[model samples]
Target: MNQNIFENISDLITSGAFLEAEQAAVDLLEEIESKDDGSQAFVIFKFNVAGFLVDIGHALSNRGYALKAVEIFESLEPRIEGVIDPHQYFYNRANAKCHIVEQVSTFDLTFSSIETLVEAKNEYWKSIKEARKVNEEFPEQYVNLANCLKRQFRLSEALWYYDSIREMAPEIPQSWINRSEALLMLNTVSNSYSGKMLHEISSGYNQASRSKFLPPDYAAYYGEQAERFRQGISENDHAETKKEFEELSEYRKYCCRSSLTLSEHGLYCSCAGAARDNLTIPLAATTVGGAFVPQMEAVLNRLKSEFSMARRCYFEYTEAEIEIDLIHEECFTDLETNECLGLDFEKLRTAFRLCFGVLDKIGFAICEHHSLKPKSGMVYFQNFWQLDRDNRREKFEEIKTPGLLALYSIATDLNEHKNGEWKNFKRLRNAMEHGFLVIVHPGSVDDIFGAYELSGDVELVELDVFEKMVEQMIQLTRSAIFSFVFHFRQKGLEESVPTGPTVSFQRVNLQM
Candidate 1:
């Protein structure tokens, strides 16, 4: 029973049923204790069960239940001494710890302790050391170690490990991702030196008297010898100034050229292109204000595609109506027979409703992408408009810019008036989505009709008017998205100050 129990548990875990395997392990342990009380068989069975449980722990960790997996692994720590391989046990434990740290960093709002990060870093280091004893060439150990170093702000050390992985396994996409991420961090740190000149002047040291300090003109007189000591502190062409500006420009290019790709799951880079089979759109790796550029691109692309499809459907419906009109006016024997000729008003209605639905979707997408606050899952586009209004009003008060204030005024008017354009649009969308009966009254002119919801008193105008309304809404949404993207881009650039000085200084003792 004990021998077969392990096999059964392994099968469950292999099939991605972690919960069932955990329950089975518990049931098997209880059965063994009840039947084989204090017997040698019970001890051997428990040890074997403990080893199987370790595998389950690792599986749970991989499946994103890192905290639970850590708990399971910790419980088996006492029994793991002789039951499992030291390298395997330590490696799994280390990976689980790293996952927990990552989860906490990303999602846990309550955890802000530095000690937790340090603990995770130590565990990763310990795991790497243990794994190396058995297999020095293990790639996972190096990768995990690199991530650990990066999390601890050890950028240079992290780069070393990432470079090592790239050299060893050049085909791995993660190696390139990690290398690029480290380079970005290093660039940010090196370029963040805004008040360097101010600081140098404030230090109260005379530039000419300072050792090895050559003013701007000193380079022309001393020729090559002066070129080496010339400082960039002056306005003119000093050798040191040329070197500084060139280095800064190079760093800026590196930062700007960093690109990310959007897939179904999340943001990736060109390095992951080979691994992904889904649609991928490449975008600059900059943040649009607080919003990410890749995410913004994905939302905008989806909105544009939906809008285009709706426009095509509208054109098709209009074309069908025009053909029916021509047939009745010129080809048909009697005008009355046009009605009996079997025009599919239902299909046209369906197409019109679809256009409305797409317009509503665009509004919701715009709100979701730009809103600073989390949206309510219950209400769709209503919440977005409300939040956007609030944000615009707040910004207007702070900056009092005329253009922003005008936008704020529009939002205010929309919110204040019950029969506002945005409100009418929202109510119409709600009716259509909730299965309210939509009636279309045919107009005297061909290809024109009045559409309205059964529950609402509002009467929509002719087909052309409706089309114009939809077109206006589509244009408004498009403009809003572009404006938000531009606003965020400017904000992000403004806030992105360098973290440290590009130049380094050394202290020397001077005796005069």
Candidate 2:
């Protein structure tokens, strides 16, 4: 508890030297334990020493050293509980446990990690409860508690905390963000209920509080109520109405007690309002780059920028897909039709144009990254083969570059498909650009459907076959991006793009 030593350890923690701070705190604790006389002055010093240990433990946890931090916090728990402010003690302890959970989640999870996660959830609850007892308006604790519930997949409970914060402090964006996330998760579960029911259900309360044991016929009875609520909310704008209906349907499916039997009692009741707690405070404004090594930071920034552009392109492609689907839904009876007579050929042509546009952007992205130039047309088959041959001839004759090889392989395999869809994709794209009137067809004619002009057929390409080709191209575009990132990292131009959770894109359903 020497003043100079205490300040030095604090400085180390502030400077992100967590290991040094931990070691200094440990040495200080040992010195305090080895004191010859247990005098009043020494006892006072012991309290300050314990505070240092807690601070060091917290610092370690903040820097991703969760396991080590948990050990320090656990060891000092009994001594630090009543000696220091109980709120601070519980808060730091909870944070250390939360960090442990975060670290465990980053790995391939195992049975052992489940127990650790449960412990972390319990600690977060304890910390929130303690903070509430001391100061009910402590918002940071509520944010942490809500976030913990979210990580636990207790979305209903998490939404309760988020909503509570929103009600208390409507101006805070994080609470709204968290609540929207919960709502989106719930909406994914169901999308057919009414707005009022959505409000009632998302409130995390049992509408029929006294009716715990719903009869077997409850679904039929509640179905009527849900229908009435849906009609009531339908007066709102279309988008808002749809959103509320979806959320309400989801709530009824998973949350409404009337939809449950006696045995299922208390199963979804954990999110009820009476059991809910929350607080509010101004949001903390901070960024997290200074913690990373300078080399890693530069690499991460560049990759992030590149991936962001790729992501935007992907998003545009997805939007085009949705638009095409909508057009098809409006115009055609069977979505899988090879030909739909009387369908607006103009709309079909425009849809195909959008789909082909995505391919061009994806191709350009790859060529630009590899420093290759295509004089004309999309860099699909011909350009890829040329680049592959040039790279092998100039760079390494024996071993092909992995990234280039991957790109060439994908392009070659797609082009040589047994169904000849890729060939039709190229033919149709070229025909469209050259002033031929594109026509939709269900099946191939003479291996490819021909584009027409006022006088004669100008080019031949099949639309039905091209459907499968488009799907493959989407996947290939994704793989091409992955290969480029891999090549960049392998070249040591930048350290490996920091690992994160695998990005999963949901399949878009074109059929209604």
Highest lDDT among the candidates is held by which one? 2
lDDT agreement with native, every candidate? 0.42, 0.44
* Tens digit per residue, CA lDDT, model 2, 1-512: 45898789877765557688888877886787788374545644655555555555554444344555566556555665445566655665665666655433211333234335445545554565566567654665676667655554344445556656756655443454455444444333223233433543433222221132332244244445434333444344335534433554332333232211111111122222111111001001212122123333343344334433433343344333445655656754443324434434443444454444444444555455445544453465424434334443343223233443444433433353322224455566566677563345755444232223243535544555344444434434434443333333333322245333222223221110
The residue-level lDDT of candidate 1 at 158 comes to 53
**CA error at residue 394 for candidate 1, angstroms:** 2.9
Candidate 2, after superposition: displacement of residue 484 in Å? 42
Q: Report the C-alpha lDDT of model 1 over 380-496, residue by residue, as the tens digit.
A: 332333423545535323432222221222232133242233445555544545644233333543322322223454433344444444543443333233333333333334445
lDDT accuracy of residue 423 in candidate 2: 43
